[model samples]
Target: MNETIGNIKSRRSIRAFKQEQIKDEELQLILEAGLYAPSAHNQQSWHFTVIQNKEILDDLNESSKEAGKIFNDKYIQQLSNNEKFHTFYHAPTAVIISGKKDSLMPFADCAAATQNMLVAAQSIGIGSCWIGLVSLVFNGEKAKKYQDKLGIPEGYQPYHAVALGYKKVKSTKAFARKENTVNYIR
Candidate 1:
């Protein structure tokens, strides 16, 4: 397989991460890969808020869980109620990806960037998890509070987050993929 395809196939959502922080150079490369992702009309509407502070990560985790408690999904509520569930899985670094509210296809653009970051991190021997639960913190009355704290721009809405750190246990295998999910034209 091609190197890029191999990297993509090897990427996994790692939850258990070591306490040691990833190097600044590695982080920069990951962020740059995100920046290089294709965007709709080249709008490049995504904004990244990198948070390395343990206190803030913990606060975001708790706040998101608090918001999830009242969510309509039972699974989310259960996760919220679980005392041991950390939104970011206690990763040493978290990057909040936000998109301009009025941009065309901001969500898609941000998602592409997020996927790019994840693949880049995996290629560099780092662990990464794409976190959607953290977006709950921006859905409640405390939205403005966190927006200010996270320094998200005035016109942007946070879409998701990526948790980054070294893996506590290396994952060596990919789970079996479902069959017949693809279609082809004759």
Candidate 2:
């Protein structure tokens, strides 16, 4: 396989991370990679909140748990068993992806940016995973308060979040892709 293809194939959802913090310069590059992702009409409405403070992380995780209980009882039950699930495998840092709520493609634009960050992190030997559960937090009062604490302005909404740090393990196996999911017109 070609180098780019190989890199894409190797990227995996890294759930476990080392306790060490990522360097600022490397994190900046990862964010820059996300900023370069394509947007609808070139609006670039996405906003990224890079969080590293332990106290704030814990608070967000707790608030998320409370919100999950209100929105998804099943998820709350699962989290009851694994507390770390509250913050995406306890990764040291998280990038909360938010976008203008009025935008027609807010989620899509934020998702593309998040994917770019994930691939860039992988290329640089940093582990990253898309944390959809965090996005669910936007539906409740407590979560809304947390969002405000994160400085996600009144007109913007959280769509996705990604956990980033160094990986605890590596895997070579590829996930089986679903067949017949795509069609090409030529």
Q: What ranges in model 1 sit over 4 Å off? A: none
Best by lDDT: 1
lDDT (Cα, tens digit) per residue for candidate 1, span 6-29: 889999999999999999999999
Q: Name the runs in model 2 displaced over 4 angstroms.
A: 72-77
Clashing pairs in 2: none
Native-to-model Cα distance after best TM-score fit, residue 159 in candidate 2, in Å: 0.7
Index of the highest-TM-score prediction? 1
Report the error of model 1 at residue 129, Å: 0.3
Model 1 weakest 10-residue run by lDDT: 168-177
**Residue 46 shift from truth in candidate 1, angstroms:** 0.3
